[model samples]
Target: MKVRVFVTPKKGVLDPQGVVIETGLRQLGFAGADQVRVGKVIDLVVHTDDRDDASARVHAMCKTFLTNPVIEDYTFTLDEAP
Candidate 1:
């Protein structure tokens, strides 16, 4: 299976990186941009039956280490391997 994880700053958190990118975009004449938020994505391939066990393990890893809950929130999507 392929796992895709997205991690982004919380709504109330300050996003300096996003702000910088947005500024650069404006300077480049991209007026269509209003807001930009920087985030992280992780893609991984794992073999399993897609059972609760495998999903639980992945979630645990994400919670305990893969992300920091203090300023970042995360979500994931799973799909069959290609």
Candidate 2:
């Protein structure tokens, strides 16, 4: 199985990188952009065919090492490996 994880700052959390990007966009005349948030995507393969097992393992991975539980939120999807 293949997994893709998305990590994002929780709402109300300060995102300095996102702020910088928003400011830069405004300076470049992209005034319509607002409430900008930045995040990351992680792609990896887990050798499993059972969806339930894969989900549990990935959830644990996210909680233990993939995200900062205090200020970050994560979501993941599983797909058949190509």
lDDT per model, in order? 0.86, 0.95
Predicted structure 1, TM vs. truth: 0.90
Q: Best candidate per lDDT, number?
A: 2
lDDT for 34 in candidate 1 is 70
User: Which is the leading candidate under TM-score?
Assistant: 2
Predicted candidate 2 versus true structure: per-residue lDDT over 1-82, tens digit per residue: 9999999999999999999999999999988989999999999999999999999999999999999999999999999857
Structure candidate 2, residue pairs in collision = none
Question: Model 1, 1-82: lDDT tens per residue?
Answer: 7788899999989999999999999999999997799999988876786656667877887899989899999888888757
Error of 1 at 72 (Å): 0.6
User: Going through the candidates in order, what is the number of backbone clashes in each?
Assistant: 0, 0
Clashes of 1: 0
- The TM-score, computed over Cα atoms with residue i paired to residue i, of candidate 2 is 0.94
Q: Which stretches of candidate 1 lie over 4 Å from their true place?
A: none
- Cα lDDT for residue 65, model 2? 97
